[model samples]
Target: MRIAGAALNQIPFDWAHNIQTISTAIAQAKAEGVELLCLPELCLTGYNCEDLFLSDWLPESALAHLQQIRPLTEGICVVVGLPVRLHQRTYNTAAVLRDGEILGFAAKQFLASDGVHYEPRFFAPWVAGETTTVEHAGESWPLGDLTFEHLGVRFGFEICEDAWRPDNVRPACRLRGKVDLIVNPSASHFAMSKTDQRYNLVLNASRNFTCTYLYANLLGNEAGRIIYDGEILIARNGHLLKRNQLLSFKEVDLEWADVDFSTPLEMAGELVPLPAPDEYRELNQAMSLGLFDYLRKARSRGFVLSLSGGADSSFCAVGVAEMVRLGVAELGEEEFKRRSGAFDEAKTEVVQTGAGGAAHQTAIDVDNAAETQNQKPDTANQALVNHLLTCAYQGTVNSSDDTFNSAKELADSIGARFFDWTIDEQVSGYVGKIEGALGRPLTWQTDDLALQNIQARVRAPGIWLLANVQNCLLITTSNRSEASVGYCTMDGDTAGSISPIAGVDKDFVKKWLRWAQTELGYEGLRYVNDLQPTAELRPLADNQTDERDLMPYVLLNRIERLAFYDRLAPAAVLAQLIAEDPAADAGQLRAYVRRFYQLWSRNQWKRERYAPSFHLDDYNVDPRSWLRFPILSGGFSEELAAL
Candidate 1:
């Protein structure tokens, strides 16, 4: 039997579009001779439909659309996701249909109602060991304990969270005597390191149950906030028969090899063993999928970066390039070439050949007219000058050359157009104008944050200007680690069309970059990953680092996960942290706790003002959607004081 997995980018609450997408996918699968095809969970109403699920007309409208789709399933078996009302209780359900007949339906057994998902409020669990019949399309369809037989093969179904449960639908099917196949339709959300877990879980479940498993997932941003990373796997016995790329939304086909279920358990087990490696491959897949969808669905051509020669920007740039490469590979050479348009044939110019030393820093003479055309004025160069002076006065060296070189190399390797703009003088003039407007000196001593913010804010206009002129999207370089504690300047480093790594922690960003460079041959862009992170606002001083300014990103990310996401109180969270580190002091603990709450509370306004970011994990901080803190709160001081 040939089974096809159709991963779709379905919009939430748009029944008509959902019907069209499903019908189109079914038609394509039928043309390809696929006997059975499975779509994502909630494909009819979308996964993140939120309160729309409670609308009085939703269930009726969904059933109507299913009836409309029933005729489209000619000569093929199709499974679709929708909310079903049985006995006046709503349940997340999958409806199986073949040849214009409704086969049966399975309700989701495990509802994810915690952390980012509130399914229990709207959906009741499917009670185990119960079988019920319901009327659908003028026929009685089994609504519970469902399994369908087609062409001598018995198949069972599950929804998104059901497969994640320890005693899930797949195992339930295994206990129901001799089922040969289990199909899962999912709408799992994206996170930096989630895909690997999903893959391993499915592989292990298929092997453990001794059945062929077909899994399909949703993709793209559903309902404007949640991103579903798509992956389709076909596993039989104990081995994976075929697997689609981790985050691909396109249709994938896997031909099933008939296997006798009566074979000895050990022999069948050897065919599909569990994934042995302990790495987070699922999270990597989620990141890739999020980036791909962010670019394609956002109608973006490519990305641009400031390339600060720091870990943050370098990691961001490499991630963008990787997404492009993956996209090209998935689309194939012909489609990629067509999408990118004509390639530039210009040769790369060698700049800064590493031969000139400080002694040979003689300014090259050029006509003032040519210099005027090539360079923006000294005022444009002020930010760099101020940065250099601050570094020099502080006896530390902060330069942009290394970062520029790294960015240039990365852009070249990725076949992206690279351009550099030196607006040091222009920026200096702008700073002077701001200072003149205020009638005083804006120095690090007087107002350090305001001073640093000005420098960062100045950089955004130029970068945005270049990105706009080149028709490329500017990639924001802030990471989850920093974003959690509000270390980024609003409309400065945080300003971008899309933030690729915003969902990942800073420590993980380093690890991922190292993995990409050492293990994945992403070597050309490693320089940025290796550099020490700094704002270059103050003259470089001994032991001056970004980590010192904010809490250690690793610790901050952990606290964020436990405190805000897991809903642990501050005292309890501190106790847990102390348990992890016995030597942690009261002062340090209180400081971290205070910082986390203060930054979190103050940054609600900033987050509210941010552009739409990719949602790759359950612990997202999107203010407009996932998190909703009031902008006028009294800050975390009161909370900390009480603690």
Candidate 2:
């Protein structure tokens, strides 16, 4: 038997594109003589259709679309997923179609409720070993936990969360010998070191169940933050047969393998060694892939950032570099930007060249004339970055020479268009206007936050103008550490369309920069990595540092992971840290815990207002994903008092 699994890029409620992509996959699979094909879970309406599943119109529209796809599956058996609404509740369901006939629906037995998922709020798990009749298209059809029989072969399903549960209730355990093929439709989001685990699980399940395993996942950034790699895997008897390239740029990616169901193969005695990409490689691919999709999908031409020469902004800058490098390497320069919807912007011809070009504010000479002569005449990767990235150093009266130089050096090294601007006069103008209105002048001693905020906020309008004029998406530079407290100024430093690093902690970004410099050969990052993290909002004489203003970043990240990520209370965090770190004083731990709770509660509004960020881990503070705290709560005051 020949079967196929497709990893399709699906957008929520994008019915026209969804049907077109799905139809194309079906046609290709049929042409390849594939007898059966399996698609990703909830692919019709998309997996990230969070609350849309509750709408009556969504299911009706999905069912109407399903009927349109049925004719295309006449030559091949297709298993497609969609949300089925019946008797006033929704079920994550898959329907089998062949010969222009609807076979039956298999409902998901388990629902994922933890860490960025709220499936239970919208769907109910199918009852085990129960079958029900559902009315559709003026006919009653079976819908429940059941096996399917077609062409004298038996098959069963394992919806996304169903296979991940570590319990005996797994469908494979029940359908072992009864089914010859086990199909898993998933919309699993990407994370570091997760692919290895998935490969092992699929291989082991196929080996243990003595059946062919076909797995497919959703691809690309569908709605906002979550990225699905669109992984397609086929394995039988402990050996992987065919796996498609993940994180595809195309709309639909399909992989197929020929299977012999008449004879069962023996499990190999030796286990195959599966490997994962290194930390840098994984981050390199994931972030680049995420940025590419984010830019194109949002219809944004390019990127704009206030390059502060700090760890946060530098990381954002490097990501744009990686996007161009990776995107160009995979797809040629023209195709790369074409796919990114940045073709018009990045492909524009320069009217002039050198230091003060029309498009490029500044340019870096790699000084690799000999290498360029030896290599390809035109370096495509560097050119792409130079076009797509428009960076500016927005300096204030309190800004230091080191930060200014750091920002300029990194921008030049990456070949980005650089602009140097000072917001000192703007800050003074705002201060003067505000003081005049109040009839009193403000001092740093009396109004420190106001003084600092004006400096940061004054820089926004000019950078925003630069971004708007260039038709680029502005990138915000705020990390999770600063987000834990209200360290960032709203409508100021936090003024961008997307915050790429907001989901990541300060320590990780710093480490990533150093690695990008020494290991990744991004020499530009060394300048920022060598400098201590500073906002540069205070006087140079103060020697202002981010760590001095708050607790150690290492400790703050730990406290955040424990208290916010792990959902631990203030008292529990204090006790646990005191026990775990012998060097920490009990009083210090208590104070840190108190400070964290207070700051976190107060900053919930800031986090809520932050530009939509990528969801990299379970620790994601984007309210759309992992963490959701009330913007106006009791401030955890009672809990802190107990500590």
Candidate 3:
């Protein structure tokens, strides 16, 4: 029997679009002679519908849509996921339909609860080997974990999280060799090299169970935060028969393969060449796709950033440049422009190399552009950036001339519209008013934090105006490291619609910045890379650097990972670090550990207040998405005192 799995870019509660997309996928699968097809989990209500699953109306609406969709699956057996309510309890369920008839419902046995998933709150796990009749659309149908047969082929299901369970609740019938197929509908989000893990699970299951495994996933930035790579894998007898492209820009991506039931299966290694894990390259690709989808979804004219020429801001700017270059390369210039709200018939024309997929020749290679001077970048891809990204450098008395030059040169190199403005007088306006209220002049010696924060805070309004007047998304410029220690001002530097890179750490950002400059051909990035990471909010004479402000970024990340990832205490962290780095000073390490614990404890409120950020990896700092820490804590005083 031939089978198909479809990956879709679905929007939440978009009933009309969701119905049309499902119908289209079904028709295409039927046309391709696919006897059975599987789509991603929660394709109807959308996987990102967080609290809506609690609503009775959502389940009713989903069932209503399912009835309309049942007619569309006339010729092929389709497994579609949606929320099913039984006895007022919701279950994450997949309905099996064929020939315009409902077969049965396969309720998910495992609700993923880790990291961005909160499925357990909304869905009850289905019991294994327990079969019950469920009332649906005025008819009773089979529910619970049961292996069903269709046209001489036995089929079973392992919904999104079920397959990952260490103690799988598969009925004895399945292990006894009665099941010939295992279909999985997943809304798996993208993380660096996560596809490999999915592959291993699919391939191993198919080999061990002697069945063909079909896996499908959601695609793109579905509900603003998590990005789906739209992966579709078909593996049979330990061999990957077919796999769809990852991170596709299209709305619906369906991959199909012909499965011959009569062929004797052999347990063997994979024959296909598995791609090596290049997370840096993959990260670049994922970020570009995510930013583009966000821009389109927000329907903003473009993006505006307060570019300080630091790694964080440069990363955001370069991310925009990549969105245009890489997007144009893949979709072709016309399609990219059409999707980007660029309606000018003549404006979207990009020079195609006609060399297969390498259409845009301007991918950040330094040798490509020797001139560092400010001019409309000779690169063809710069035109797209010029149209989409507007950047400004808001300098103050404490801001250095180096950052200002770096911001301008980088903006000019990338063809982004650049504006230079100084807010020294404005900084004094607030400082003077506050001093007047206090009946005394504020001195830097007594009010350093307030003075520095005011400098950062003063820069927010003018750049905000740049974003507002231009109708663009103002990208915030704080990284995970700074965010961890509350190194950023509350409403100052943190003011923006989205914090794109806040999920990632500062050490990686600096590493990526250097790599982007020297290896990735972004010559403009070299300036930022060369400068030491400094907030520069303090006077130049003080030589204020981010490292001096807190601990070293590398050490901070290590201590954080040890504490958060490994769940270790302060003394344990110090001991581990000392053992790991024998040459490092023990006293310094202890001090760093204490600082990290104190800062992390006191800064939970800042993390709670950050704008919605991208969910990057397994260890996310975003309180809403992954990690949850109490805003009120003892600053780990007792934990530190023991050390």
Candidate 4:
């Protein structure tokens, strides 16, 4: 028998879009002679419906929609995921349909509640050994702990969270002798290098159960904050049969394989090991795809960035470039523009004609012979980027000449419309008003923070007006290290519609910039890569650097991981720091630890108010997604004192 799995990019409750994608997948499967097909978990209603799953009407609506899909499965056995309401509770279930008839539903026995998942809030875990019936449209079917048969092959299910349990307790363990195939429909999220762990799980499950295993996962940024890699796998007896290229740009990606359940295959030397995962390349793909979905789904025209010629902002600019490059590569130029919903026939002409050029704006010139030599000329990718990205260098007197050159060269190299403007007048006006009100001239020695922050705050209004006028998303440049210790001004640098790198750390951002520059062929990054990171909100004579204002970003990131991801107390974090950094002075490590705890405790409000950010790495400091803290705590005074 031939088996298949499809990964779908679905939107929450978009009835026409979701059903159309499912119908397309079913048609393709039937055409390819697939005997059994597995769709992603909750592909009917989408997995990220949040609290709507708790409402009574949602499950009912999902059931009503299921009827629409039944007729499409006339020739093949199809497994679909949706919410099934029974006895005043909702259960995440996989419904089996064979030749236009409703078979049984297999309810998920485990609910995921860790990290970004809160499945327990909206779903009730099914009892392991219990079976029940669900009535819909005046018809009833079995709804729990069930198995089915197709083409003389017995099969059972392990929903997304079910297989994450221990081997002895998972559904596959129980179905070992009873079934010949185990199908898992998942809505698993994408993190850096997380696919390897999942690959091991599926291979081992088949070996332990002596059965063929098929897995499917949801794809793309379904709603917001979470991205699914859209992975599909088919294996038998610990040997891998099939896996798709993840993070696809297509709406539906399907993979299939033929398996013979009659013959018992030897497990020895059957498994083919997947090559080591490259996280740098992985992040590039995930971030590019995430931005593509967010752009089209939010109905925004394009992206507007405050390009300060630093690592974080430069990283974002390249992300948009990569989005256009990779998107147009997979999806043809016409389809990519159509799917974006930003560029129409009229807009495409405007982009190609260079109507949005920065000729009228002040332009900065870079004095590097190598930069001029390495700059790329116009291409299809650059032409699309010219339309999709708009950048501005909002400089003040404190801003540097090197950063201006950095911003302009990168924007030019990527074909992004670049504008160079000064914010010194606005900063001076605000400072004058405050000085007049206080009847004293503000000096750096007396009002250091106030003087520095006014410059950052003043740059927000003009960039916001540009974003508003162009109908673009304003990109915030703060990284997770800045977010961890409140190293940013609230209404200043943190003001944006999206924070792309807030889930990643500053140390990684800097290193990734170099990697992208050298390996990814973005020669414009030479400027930013050569310069040290700084706010430049202080006088040039004072020589302000990020490390001078805060601790080293490496140490800051380590402390953040220990405190939040590891859930360590202040004293424990200090002890771990000592062990990790043995060459560092003990007194200085204690001071850095104390400073980190104090800043973290007082900065919960900032993290709470940040724009929605992607969950890229294994963990993030976003208060709403991965971590939470009190807005007004004791500032960790007692804990720091003990440290």
Candidate 5:
């Protein structure tokens, strides 16, 4: 028997569109001569429907859509996910239909009720050893653990979280009788290091059950809350039969070996079950998928960045270019600006500065400097400032040669239009304006957060101006590590339409940059990657490293997962940290614990205000969606006092 699996892009709360998408897939499967097709979990209604599940009309509409799809399954067996209401309780269920008849159904047993998911609040657990049959359209269909025989192969069905349990489908299917194949229709949310575990589990389960395994997942943004990675894997007898690497809408067929029910034990010998490892392949795939879908779904033309000669901005530029390259091949230079809104008419004029401020002398000095340096003088600071102002903005009164040159080279390499503008005079004017507004001169010290914020805040208007003029989206350059401990300024470094690398830690950002340089051959990225992390707000003497200001990102991420998401107490988390790093000091641990709670709590307000960020892992801090914390609560002072 030939089986096909489709990874579909599902829209949240859009029943008509979802049915149309499913109809297209069914047509494709039929064209491919597929007898049985497995779609993602909750294909009718979106998986991350949140409170929409509680609405009476949602289930009714979803059921109607499912009925509309029933006719399309005339020649093929289709398993689709939908919420089934039974006596006022909802069950996350999958219905198998063929030839306009319901064969059987399976309910999700293992509900993900913690972290970013609260399935238990909406769905009632399907009690084990219980069976029920429902009459739909005058036909009675059996529910719970049951196998359907078609073409001499006994097939069992399960939902997303159901397969995650130890004895979920295996024992039940074994108890019922011999089954040749098990298909899991899932809507698992994206999380770092999850895909590796998922693939391993599927492979191990196939070996343990001695049956063919078909797994299909939902993809794209669901309700703008969670990103689902679409992966379809077909495995048999401890070996992978076929897999699709692209974690979006796609299809795969696996018909390598026939399932023989009589000799099921023969295939079980090849199964090797090992403990799940912490490989982050799924996280990477999820990140890339989020980027791709956000760009496409938002109908965004492209992205633009300031392209500072620093780690954060440079990393963002590289990530944007990489996303564009991967999604669309050889994205040309013109298309970049056209899509990014970077090529609008100049709104500002650029003024070149000579040794003192004469245009003729400045041009002559530029020539002499170029001749002496054996480089194009016009291509240096002054020329860069001119290009930036003309292409990216309207007016620039002064320009810097060195900074502009570096930015130009970086943008050129990434196939983006590069412009340089010197904001020395404008920045000084803004500083004066801010000082006058406050009627005080600012001091330079640790207590000068307001003063520092002004500097960062001033940069936003012009960049935003450029973004708006060009019809392009600005990419925010804050990394996950810094965001954990509140190291970013609201509307400053945090100002952008999307945060591409917010899900990645500082250490991982460096690693990805290095990989881009050595493997991707983007040498301009190497300069930024090699430099030490700094905000570059003050002079070199005020050199501030992010790690010095906040806890180490790796440790912070682990602590966040364990303490916050896993619900481990402070003392227990400390014990785990000490065991992992024996050199951790009492003072450092106490400070991190205190600061983590403070920043985490205080940043809820900021996180809530942030633009929609990609959901790359299970540990996201999107307050409006994934996580919800009271913004006006008393800070972590009371919690720390208890410790």
Candidate 6:
């Protein structure tokens, strides 16, 4: 028997789009002669519908949509995931269909409630050894913990989180000797190096249960914030059979392998390990795909960036370039443009006229005659990038020449449309107005933070106007490290539609820029990578730096992980930091820890107001998704005093 698993990129409650992708996968699987096919968990309605699962109409609509897929399974056995509502509750279930007839439904017995997942809030766990019935279209089908037989072979399910449970409690343990195959449908979010753990889980389950195991996952940024890698795996009794290329820029990705259930399996060769994953490459692909999906699904024209020529903004600029490079490589140019929703031949004209023509006439335009033609003619990827990315250097009087060159060169190298404009005039106007209202002149010594923040804040309006004019998303440059402790200016640098690097820390951002410079061949990164990381909002005489304002980024990230990810208290975090960095001074470590806790407590409001950010790592500080804190709290004062 030939079995297959498909990873689908679906939109939430978008009936037409979801059904089209599902139909495409089923048609492709049937063409490949796959007898048993398993789709990702919640593929019918999409995985990230948030609170929509609570609505009876949504689940009823999903059930109605499932009927459309029934006829497509005329000659094949297909297992598709969807929410099955019984009584007043909902259950995450995989329905088995054989030759256009509903066989039965295997409901998930485990619910994921940890970071980035709140499944238990919406789905009730199916009781073990229990059977129920669901009625649809005047016909009833068996639902709840169940297995089915097709073509003399029996199979069971572990819908997404069910397989992640303990070996003793997971559904597969009970189906060990009872079933010949175990299929897992998942909507696992993408995180670096997480695939290795999943690979082991599937292969070990098949070996322990003495049955063939098949796994599939959802694809792309399905609804925003969460990215799915669209992985597919097939294995039999400890022997790996098939695995698809993960994070593909495709709507439907399918992989299959032949399994001989009647004959004895040979166990001569051990399961060959998948090549070690390079995190840099993984992030590049995940971010590229995430951006592509966001640009198209949000129905936005493109991305507008305030390219500060710093680490965070530089990383984002390169991300857009890589999006064009990787997307065009996978889906051809025309399809890539069509899927992006806003990229068209007219956009090319907009770039030539709007971006180019306007630059020639403004006094704020710092470009010389030679710099106006920075985008090369022969590079098709660059030309596509020019349409998709529009960047401006919103410089102040305090901005440096090195950063200006960094932003321009990098944008030019990647074929992104570049503009340079100074916000000094606006900064002065705001400062003078504030002085008149207060009847006092604000000096840097008395109001240093306000002085620095005004320069950053003044740059927001012009860039926002540019983004609005182009119908593009404005990219915010704040990363996870800055978000951890209120190192960022709210409504200033933090003002944007999306924060791409908000999940990753500053330490990683710096290293990634260096790696991108040498390995990824973005030579334009050399400028930013050479300079020290600074906000550059202060006068050059101050020689301000990020590490001076806060602690070293390495130590800051350590404290953040301990405090949030590990859920440590203030005293415990300080102890852990001292133990980890014993060579450093203990007093300064204590100071940094106290500062982190205070800033983190006060910044909850800022984090609450931050633009929607991607969940790239295992954890993030997004209150809506991973972590939640009160906007008003005690600020950890008592605990800090003890430290």
Error of 2 at 253 (Å): 2.5
Across 119-178, the per-residue lDDT of candidate 4 in tens digits comes to 999999998889988988899999999999999999999999999999989988899899
For residues 1-643, what per-residue lDDT tens digits would candidate 1 score against the true structure? Answer: 7887788877777776688788888988887788888888988988877766776578767877889988998898999998877677887889999999888888788888655678887888888667788775676878875778876778887677877777544444444346778889998876645666777777777767767778888876555456676667777655766666555634232223334444543424434344564244555555555655555545554456776666777666556555445545566533533433322232221122111121111111222212354454332122111111100001012345555566666545443444454444544677799799999887767877876676677667766765665455677778777776678889888888877667667787777777878776766667767676666766445344787788777888888888778888777787788888888786797788778888887777777767666665567776644665788887756567876
Model 6 Cα lDDT, one tens digit per residue, 232-259: 9898888889999999999999999999
Backbone clash count, each prediction separately: 34, 0, 5, 0, 14, 0
lDDT of 3 by residue, 206-308 (tens): 8777778899999888888899999999998888988988988877899999888878877776545478887777778888888888888787878888899
Query: TM-score of each candidate?
Result: 0.75, 0.92, 0.92, 0.95, 0.79, 0.96
Query: Clashes in model 6: which pairs?
Result: none
Q: Please report the candidate that would top lDDT against the real structure.
A: 4
lDDT for 349 in candidate 3 is 22
lDDT scores of the candidates, listed in order: 0.66, 0.83, 0.82, 0.89, 0.65, 0.88
- List runs of model 5 lying over 4 Å from the truth: 15-17, 86-88, 129-146, 168-178, 222-225, 237-239, 246-265, 270-285, 329-406, 422-434, 445-447, 469-471, 551-562, 565-568, 571-593, 624-643
Worst 10 residues of 5 by lDDT: 355-364
Estimate, for each residue in 1-643, the C-alpha lDDT of model 5 and write its tens digit: 7776787777776777788778888888887787788888888897877777877777767776777887888988988888877777787888898987778778777788666678988888787667898656666778875667777778887677777777655333453346778888888877765777788888887876667888888876655547776777788767777676545422122222233445544454454443463324344445545655565556554455655666667666655555444433323333433432323443323233222122211111322322355544224333222222212211222222333444556665654555544455555677688679988766676436765665566667777776666455777778766666678889987888888667666777777677768776788775566566656555445666566667676777887777666777676777777788888796788778777877877776777777667666556666654667788888757667765
lDDT of 4 at 640: 84
lDDT of 6 at 73: 92
The better candidate by lDDT, 1 or 6, is: 6
Cα-based lDDT at residue 373, candidate 3: 47
Model 3 misplacement above 4 A = 167-176, 269-273, 342-380
lDDT of 4: 0.89
Give lDDT: candidate 3, residue 54.
85
In the predicted model 2, the residue pairs found to clash are: none
